[model samples]
Target: MTNPVKGPTGRVPGWVKVVGSVVLLLAVLFAGLRLSVLPGLKDLFGTETRDRSGPALLESIQDISRYEAASGNFQVVVDLEKDAKFLPDAVRGSRTLYVGAGTVDAYVDLGALDGDDVRVDDDRTSATLRLPHARLGTPALDPERSYAVSKQRGLLDRLGDLFSDNPHSEQAVQKLAVRHIGDAAKESGLTGRAESNTTEMLENLLRSLGFKEVRVTYGD
Candidate 1:
C-alpha cells in the first residue's frame, strides 16, 4: 500500500462521515413518516372510519295545515346524576353534563277555521275574523348541535358499560331538555308574537281582496 494516506488535522475519518450520512438519512425518513409525506406508510398506520348505517326509511307523511308564525331557539345545559341507594358515588353512581339546542314553533291552526270565523259586510268593504289562539308546537331538538360535555361514572358503572349495548343512554336527559325548552317557549311570549303576525297577515290579505277595513280577534 502507498503510505497510509494521513488526512489533515481535525478532519473526520471516512467511516465517521459514512455513519453521519446514514444517521441523517434515517432522521429524514422518520421526519417524513411523521409529516405524512409517504402516502403508503401513512395509510399503514392511519385509522379508517366507516359508516355502517342503513338507508333511512320513509315514514308516514301528514299534511300540515297550521301557519308557522314564530319560532324560538333555545339552549339548555342538563346535569343529571344517578346513584344506588346504598352505594357511594365511586362505587355505583354516575353524572353527566349535556348541552342541548332546540327550536319551538308557535303556529295558528287555519285548519280549525269554520264559517263563523269569518264575517263580511253586505258591500264587502269591511270584514271580521275570529280565529283560535296561537299554540306552541312540540320542541324539536337539534341533534347535530347538541352534545354531552362531560361524563363521570363509578367503577361499577364503567364495568357494566363494557357489556351493555347502550352504554350511555341519553333519553332521560333529552326528555328533560325538551321539557325545559317547552317551558321556556311558554314564557317567551312566542304565542303572542304569532297572534300579532297572524293578525297582520290576515289584515293585509283581506285588504288586497277589496276590503277597506279588517278586524281580527283571537278566541277559543
Candidate 2:
C-alpha cells in the first residue's frame, strides 16, 4: 500500500485544518447573531414590566372646619449611621444621608365657637368675640421634594438587603424629618402669625357687616 502524504514537522494535518476552518466560520456566525438578533430576542422575552396594582378605593370624607392662616416650609438634612458592636464599619455598618422637605400649617378652628363667644352692642355698631388660639397641624412631607443624598453599606448590610422586601427603607429618616420640621414651625412664630391673620380676617368681616368697632380676643 502507498504511504499517505505527510506534511512538514510541526505542521497541522489537512483534516485538522478543515475542522478549524469550520469552527472559525461557526464562531463568526454566532458573533454576528449576538450583535444583531440577541438584543431583540431579549426585549421580546424577559425585559418588559407590567403594573398589577388594584384600583384605588375611596375611604372616607371629612368636613374641614379649621381655617388655614399660615404655612411654613422647611428642609432638613438627616445623617443616620448604624454599626455593629464589635465589627468595623466596612464589615457591618451603614450610613445614609437624606434631604427632607415638608410643610406645616397653622389654623384656627371655627367649629369650636359657641353662641356666648360673640357679643354685639345694643346699637349693633360694635362687636366682641372670644376664640381659641391658633394651633399647628401635622407636618406633611413632600415626597417629590425629598430624596436620599448618599448611602454607604457594609458587605453584610448589602447581603441582607438581597433577602429583604424593603431593601432601603426611609421610614426612620422621614419620621425624624417630620419631627424636625414640626419643631422648626413651632419656633418660626407660625401660630402667632396665624392668630394675627385670623384676627384681621374677623375684624374685616365684622366691619363689612355694619359693625363700626370690632374687638377680637383669643383664650386658652
Candidate 3:
C-alpha cells in the first residue's frame, strides 16, 4: 500500500501529473483490494468491525499469534458487511473470539495462561508459547495453562499482501501503516487510494479482533 509517488496531481502544476497518476494507480489498487475482501472486509471500513456469534470460545483456536493489537481500549462500529453490531461485540466481553494484528515481538504472556520455559532473544524481539506438561482444553479454558498460539494468516494479514507488490510481502502493510501514519499520519492525509485501502485493512483487522475504537490518521 505504499504508493510513494514524487508529487501531486492534475492540469494545475508540475507535480500534479505524477502525483495524480500515482493517486489513480493507488486508487485502482485500493479498489481491487476492496473488491478482493469485499464482504469480508465490510466490517472494518472507516471505523471498526465485530462479529457476534454464540458463546463461541477460542475453544482450541490454535495459533493466535503474529498480529498483535497493541494495548488499547475498544470502540464499537457496525459491520459494513452485515446488519449486526460489529465492533461492540469486543466491548461486550464475555466468552470471546478475537482477531488482532501487531508487532508480535513474539512474546508469550505467561501471566495470561498455562505456560513455562520462558525464553527471549538477545534483542528481546521474539518469544514462544510453552506449557508446563499441561495440554489445551476446549469450552473450559484453564486460566492456569495453555499455549499462546500465534499464526499469521488472518483475513487482513492475507489481504494486506493481495497485490501490494511489496518487498516484505503482505506483512509490510502493518509496518507501512504504522510508519506513514506514525504521529503525524493522522487527520489530514486520507486522500490516496492504496494508502486509504491499507487504512481500511488495518481497521478491519482491529475490529475483527475487537479493538473497535481505532483512531485512524492517514498520510499522503
Tell me the tens digit of each residue's lDDT in model 3 across 1-220: 4335432432355576778899999999999788668886655555556877768566565655322212221111111111124544223212211221222111112233432344444554444333222111111222233222233343433455576686232233333333432322222232233334434555576567655354444211
lDDT of 2: 0.91
lDDT by residue (1-220, candidate 2, tens digit) is 4335445565668898898899999998897677666666645445567999999999999999998999999999989899899999999999989999999999999888888998998999999999899999999999999999999999999999999999988898899999999999999999999999999999999899999999999996
Error of 1 at 51 (Å): 4.4
- Taking all chains together, each candidate's TM-score versus the true structure is 0.77, 0.77, 0.16
Model 3, poorest ten-residue lDDT window? Answer: 73-82
Deviation in Å, model 1, residue 31 alpha carbon: 21
The C-alpha stretches of model 1 lying farther than 4 A from their native spots are: 1-43, 47-55
**Model 3's TM-score against the true structure:** 0.16
> Model 2: clashing residue pairs?
none
Local distance difference test, per candidate? 0.92, 0.91, 0.37
Task: Give candidate 3 regions above 4 Å deviation.
Answer: 1-12, 40-220
Candidate 1, residue 200: how far the Cα is off, in Å: 0.9
